[model samples]
Target: MIFIEVIKKRFGHFEGETVWQWTMINDHGMKISVLNYGAIITSIETKDKFGEYANISLGFSDMDDYLAYSPYFGATLGPVAGRITKGQFSLDGEEYQLTQNEGANHRHGGKLNFSKKLWNVSVEKELDQIVLTFEYTWADGENGYPGNINAHMTYTLNNKNEWIIDYTAHTDKPTIYNPSNHIYFNLSGKAGSTILPHQLWVNSEKFLPIDKEMLPIGEIRSVENTIFDLRAGREMMEIIKNQDELLQIAGKGLDHTFILKHENGKPDAVLFDPQSGRRLEMETEADSVLVYTSNSMAGDFEINGKTVPKYAGITLETQGLVDAINHPGFGNIVLRPEKPFKSKTAFRFAVES
Candidate 1:
């Protein structure tokens, strides 16, 4: 059975509205904490091979920390995740400009992105799993997007230790809609420790090359001879230390979106930490997965009273291709009134024994 609790009541208030947090414990003893603000996954506790439970998700213990300094920690990113060239996009022969928060480009929506908004939350038991649902409605022209979009995200923790995220959205007008969860995972369960020891395997043999600004340059290149080749499991540190130009351009680490070869049930990526013997298999239906190694953390934020330095965690963001709206060759990110949008991504946890 799954046990659910409201560990924090009125965790914070946004726009004079009360926001709350909920905790769900699965039968396997996996615990997940979520907040209404940003529909964030505050914490995820799982056992290692030694049977010791620890929080594997990088986040702050205090709500104030989340409000003051959150680098998209455990937050849901939407209307359109990733960057749009020059904060501009054309839809139906008309151009629209968005609020530029990330330099000259619009990133993860806009200046007032979904990650900073409050969501209406609900919890219910779906079979043996505890499902936490978060809903948010974006008005037309909010952040300069052209639609009144209604988004629903559900987090389900099952007995098998799988945390499944289901995302669905409907837009009244034609607009770009690519949503993703930006939860940083450190299988070592130590927030302060670097995730360099973790081994990662991505099923993709190709990744989008990005410019200095971190926006995809519209070129999908092969990962064969570069450090981007994670088709076979490789330690993150080994790949980081490689003298690859792309790695140098990306701040000496990974912050690129890999073109996922598989579309459905197949696992898109696998991450394992040898020290803790903790393993995570990511299965998603999204077209691409953004692998960010937290290279720009700056060691300024404190999580659980410990300083979180650079490379402390890795974020696997599965969503429609980055900057899809600007690249015609990229996957479709348009959501119209006649057709709703839907996507699912699952993170299954286990021990390597």
Candidate 2:
């Protein structure tokens, strides 16, 4: 059996409006805390082999850290999930300019990205699962995007210790859309510790190559002999020590998008922490998975009043290829009036024997 509860708390004010927080728990010992601001998952607690519940998602205990420079923490990325060169894209013979938040590129939307917006939240129980739905509408020309888009996301935690995220969106005009959740996970459930000891296996044979600026250079390369190869499940620390050029370009860590070998709704990656005996299986309908190690953290943010250093967590962002809007060969991220956008990603947690 699963249980759902709504606990209202003050999450600070945004745009002269008060934001709220909600906490959801299940019978399987899974608990999730979320906020309507950015529809962010503030905390996710799960049991380890020793049957101790620990919060695996990284964030601050206070609301101020999030309202400040959060580094994307557990926020929802939208409008576009990756970089668009020079913050410019053309659609239907017209060029659209976006805010360049990441140097010369428009990353994870724009200056006022979806992560900073407040969403409407609703709760419901379906069968044995508790679902928290968050809805937000973006007006045309918001952040320089040309569409009045409505987006909805449902986060469901079930009896099987599975957290499923369902995303759907509709647009009034033709636009590019690629939404994803940026939840960094540390199976050890301990902040300030690196995730290098974890083992990772990505079900991918190819990965996109990025330039020094961390933007995709329109090349899809094989992961056979490089450190990007995780088919046999390598320790993340070992991969980080390799002197590969691609890894150097990404701040000496793994931050590239791996092209999935499976189709939609198939298992894409597996992450296991031997020390904690916690295993995570990720399945998604998105075309690619961007695996990012928190290399830039460097004690920048405080979690529970303690500093969270670099490589504290790993992010498996499942979405369309980076820069897909400008690259015709990458993948289709265009959403027209006739067809709405839909995608799903799920994380199944278990104790490995």
Candidate 3:
């Protein structure tokens, strides 16, 4: 049976305000805990080969840590997924300026982006799955982005060990929109603090390289002869430790985007941990996957009561190309009233017998 629970986690910043934790537990020993504040996922627990359950998703045990130290941990990102050069973009002959929160670039919908907001949630129970739909409305001038957008994110957990995320949004005027979550997975759970022992495989032959400014240079380089090539699956430790220019440029590890060759949820990637015998299968309806190793961690955060390492987890964010607004060929991030935004990504967790 699938079970769902709602618990009051803590008090909010304002009087009479509160934060909540919603957990969905499947019969097969998989549990997912999400918070209403930022609609952030706090836990993703699954059983390993030895039939012991642990949280494989990196996050804090307290809500305060999330507010102070979260690097978009398990939070939804939007308005735009990546950096906006110099916090400026033009659409339909109109120039717009966004909040220059990250140096001179507008990143991840600004400082108080979607990752740090409260969302209204509605729960739905189907015969086999529990769906937690989180919704947030963005004002046109809130982040210097044109048009008001009503965004929706649906999280579904079923007994089949699937956690599916479906994103949908509608804008009242012509604007830009690219949304994805920043959930990092380690697969090894409490067995390991770093993702070095994990193996990753992505369904892509090319990757987007970034300059010193951490924005794409408009070149979609082939992954051949590069450490970014994980088409055949490889351990992350060797790749992360390689003296690769791109890796070093990306904070000493991967923060690159891979142009996906598959679509319509046809198995875009896989993450496995030999120690736990846990495997995570990913499928998405996105054109690209941003594979980010948590290379920027300063060893301040804890996962499962243990301090995490720099490469504590890896994020396979299925979203559009970063800063696609400036690059016409990178893919469209434009949202019009006539056309809405819709994307889906599914994470299937399993273990070898």
Candidate 4:
């Protein structure tokens, strides 16, 4: 808990506004870069078992790249993180329609959602932690949603090598809210490297099955005998190479939500790279973890001077169920004026020998 500071560096201009990167460093020499634009995380540097540090989080260094070619990357995704069946839903007995960004579904709150907006930043440093707050407010009908919401995403980089995120929001009307950080991780630190070699473990025995459109088909099936089973920790390549029909539906990999069985704030999932001995543990207040193996990661854009192909990174999005507005018994995504939204998701990185 010795030396810790957050340094702000000028990144560049997006549109006409200047964007900056705030890099926070902790006593353990773990550093993380955050951007005011998109409220995105651009980097997370941590050590492996060999004491070598590398940035494991996927993102672009420049503002132009983030604005054009980035896939959510390390951005904060919200009002709702997953897909809405047909870009339509009914909340409070009133039907609502969201602009479709995916084929026939609404995803990540559309293209101009939280990830595209510039958020106001505030910093608070304490003896053991540095908290960065990104705030934004949207009108009631901004994205065809009902509510004026004041949302805040708080990130804390502590001496324990933990990058913790806490999401808070208050709305003036009834609205469906499910926020999640859309960060893809490649423990090897090589953008061109695939995560197929990594081992993943989820604290779930059940997963939501998806149809050909990648939307949940209203089933909470058991993962006991399926490739969705990760409770025993499975290698990514093993799961990808399986002959499961769902694999083909999701383009050869995962794009499903695993219902969490976390208890007493325990980690809901863990990912480890055996080669580097780098491990990442995640705990969240969300009901499920959206497991996306970057099934369709395009290699057109470069990162670390190399293009990362499909499965190059994996996103463990912790949030309520996808299309939760349509599935009341699955998970409640409703946010009312009387019951503001509050959620926490933490990622702890370490090296295990």
Clash totals for all models, in order?
Answer: 0, 0, 0, 0
lDDT of 2 at 89: 91
Q: Which residue window of length 10 is worst by lDDT in model 1? A: 1-10
Question: Which digits, one per residue and each the tens of the lDDT, describe model 2 over residues 148-214?
Answer: 9999899988878898999999999999899999999999999778899999999999999999888
Residue clash pairs of candidate 1: none
Clashing pairs in 2: none
Q: Which residue segments of model 3 deviate by more than 4 Å?
A: 1-16, 263-266
lDDT rank, highest first? 4, 1, 2, 3
Instruction: Give model 2 RMSD, 1 decimal.
Output: 1.6
What would the per-residue lDDT of candidate 3 be over residues 1-353, giving only the tens digit for each residue?
43544334553442245777888877675889898888889889999999999988977777778877858888888878778899898999999999999899998899888888888988887766889999999998988998999999999999789999999999999999998889999888862378898899998999999999889998889999888889999899888889989889989888999999995545899999999999999999888989899889887666556677788889988899999998878999999999999999999999986
Q: Please report the candidate that would top TM-score against the real structure.
A: 4
Q: In the order shown, what is each candidate's alpha-carbon RMSD?
A: 1.5, 1.6, 1.9, 1.2
Candidate 1's TM-score:
0.97
- TM-score against native, each model: 0.97, 0.96, 0.95, 0.98
Which of the two candidates, 1 or 2, achieves a greater lDDT against the reference?
1
Worst 10 residues of 4 by lDDT: 61-70
The TM-score between candidate 2 and the true structure equals: 0.96
